[model samples]
Target: MKARLPFIFIIITMMLNSIGIGLILPVMPSLITELTGGSISSAALWGGVLATTYAVMQFFMGPTLGNLSDRYGRRPILLISLVAMGLDYILLSLAGTIWWLFAGRVIAGITGATFSTASAYIADISAPEKRAANFGLIGAAFGVGFIIGPAIGGFLGEIGPRVPFMAAAVVALGNATLGYFVLPETLPQSKRRTFDWTRANPLGALMSIRKIPNLTGLVVVFLIFTISHQVYPSVWSYYTIERFDFTPKMIGASLGAFGFFMAIIQGGVIRMIIPKLGEMRTAMWGMGLNFVVFILVAFLGEVWMLFALMPLMTLGAIAGPALQGIMSKLVDDDAQGELQGIFASVTGIALILSPITMTSIFKYFTDSDAPYYLPGAPFLASSLLEISAMALLFVIAKRIWGTAATPAQ
Candidate 1:
């Protein structure tokens, strides 16, 4: 129990950060509505703008923060980020104008870029063989937070739009206080390196990945898989509502189930599977399974089928931890934060592009006057993308490990 304390603290910190983000989601649109004098469409437009602002800031600042953590130590950076996020929520709660809200979101984005540092912190304490399971724990923490946060936020929003913001602020500050007292610095001064601004930006950070041996292809596969997975989030609610007439309650229930299943798989199943299957084989299995599931989901006619398929869908959660573990092994101790930051930036790029691509595909197919309407077109596209990623992964594996690489010894 004494030895496990640091890991527990890290997970709790991650959960608190995720919960703060989740708390805002259920209330943001309505909050925008009130601020914009009840123009729903305008509110939605501004909401998109606010979201873009956040993502853009994250993309730019992620590497910087990660590099800072490497130089200054993870404890100070993580604590500062938590405190800043809490203050950002407070600012949002008090905002009377749209610009103020934007400012709050910008601050949130900069502070919320701490995940890379958090990943590095986990890497600092974990052995190479154990890193995947530890990273999976982080995913589980996020899953639990997402499950609880929105439910509580939605309930709080009934009292007022700003209620959830204020509540989230309190939660964040409390978590920061806990962290300040309990969180220990993972990166020792001997392992620390001087911060370089040139390699701290997104492009330079990506270039740094290229300099690592045998990692270019793996990084490509990671980016492609990340982008393809965004299809679920971008079109799931719309697809279900259009196809099965699902209510908001049904959608919420489905999401909750997904999060719960993901948590269970990541927290428990992954640790068992990685040792037996090996990281490369496990990742291949996950990507292949996801390809099949995406295609099945695209064509399913019955609502019950969605629920039945969800368990199978959860198997694909193995890919992320496996891939991250492999990447962590390839990099040195000092560069873990930089690697994670670059990956975060890659995710940011995918977030920017996937929503536009997937939604446009959905819209084109679902339109009444389209050449031929197939609501599942976006899913089909996603399946093809996954196949591409799988094929690339296979090629890279063969190139690196020869024929013996399939089962990974």
Candidate 2:
């Protein structure tokens, strides 16, 4: 038990990282309405505001926390983040009104550093060759957590909306306790770098990453792929309902299936494939597979077809870990936290932008007064973005991740 404690702690942290948002999603509406004494639609608008506030704060803080871990070390930052997270969940549980909820979300967002820091922790302990596969474990943990989160939230939501928040509090604080006891500081004093406040925001982090010779283009590729990948979360429910008349239960089942398949591909499949094909080939294959799947989803004719494509749909999970590993190898040991921060910031931007863009496209196409109707238009746009990322990656592969840059194993 002692021998595996670090890995165990990390797995729990990773799962809590993803579970935090999802566990509350199913109950937020009821909670919001209870506090606001408003209509369901008004509660929904407030919910969106809370969600955006959380994302925006996370965007600003990603680099700050990453650089802090770089300077101070991962252990303190992670433990503090976890405790703060647990406290915020408690705040949410005891929230009496809408403003209380807003305050809780704000606190939650500012301290949400677990994912970035945990990535750095993994990078610290992992070898160059093994980094990608280990990164896949992060994905796998997140997938399974996300699948469990909403289920628990929905179930507890029936008893009371506040119940899920308390549940989240327990999970978070318990994880913090485990981490405190077993988690070692992965970043040693000799390896620690000075934390500059200059490169501690989104644009600054991008500039900092830009200084790394081979990573800038890959960052661009990563950004586009992330934005494109947002299609599912942005419009999947709306599209499925508008086109196929899917009910809430059907949507949940489909999404649950997606999460399960993603866990399998990232946890087991990538470990097997990356060893044989190498990170470069593994990434190319996954992104290429994504392009095909996106196009198929865009033009899909039948409800059954989407379900049939589910297994193939998740194969795209491989690209993210592969790309992450490739970039991890290119970066110096000291900068892993910053690199992970860049990835986090990029994700934050994508989260902010993609929903607006994709949903707008979906709205335009599905609107009664539109020029033409195509419910799957957002997926089509995503396919175009995916192909563009593929093209850019192909162009820059040799320059960035080639034999010279990657070095011989």
Clashes of 1: 0
Q: Write the per-residue lDDT of candidate 1 for residues 84-146, one digit (tens) a residue.
A: 989999999999988899899899999998877888899998999999889978877887987
Model 2 lDDT at residue 42: 45
- Which stretch of 10 consecutive residues in model 2 shows the poorest summed lDDT? 400-409
Deviation in Å, model 2, residue 318 alpha carbon = 2.9
Global lDDT scores for all candidate models = 0.79, 0.77
TM per candidate: 0.74, 0.71
Give per-residue lDDT, candidate 2, residue 19. Answer: 76
RMSD for each model, in Å, please?
A: 4.9, 5.5
lDDT of 2 by residue, 1-409 (tens): 7766787788778888777666776667567768988644344346556766777778778768888999999999999999999999999899998999999988998887556678888888888898888887887788888877766665666678788889899999998898898999989899999999875757655668867877888888888888888777666656776678654445546666667777777668888988777777777777888888988998888989998998887888687877788788889999997797688778888877776677677767766676888877888898888889888877887665454223222
Off by over 4 Å in 2: 2-7, 25-52, 66-80, 90-104, 117-140, 154-163, 174-196, 199-205, 208-215, 237-251, 272-285, 299-303, 322-345, 366-374, 394-409
How does residue 401 of candidate 2 score in lDDT? 49
| Local distance difference test, candidate 2 | 0.77
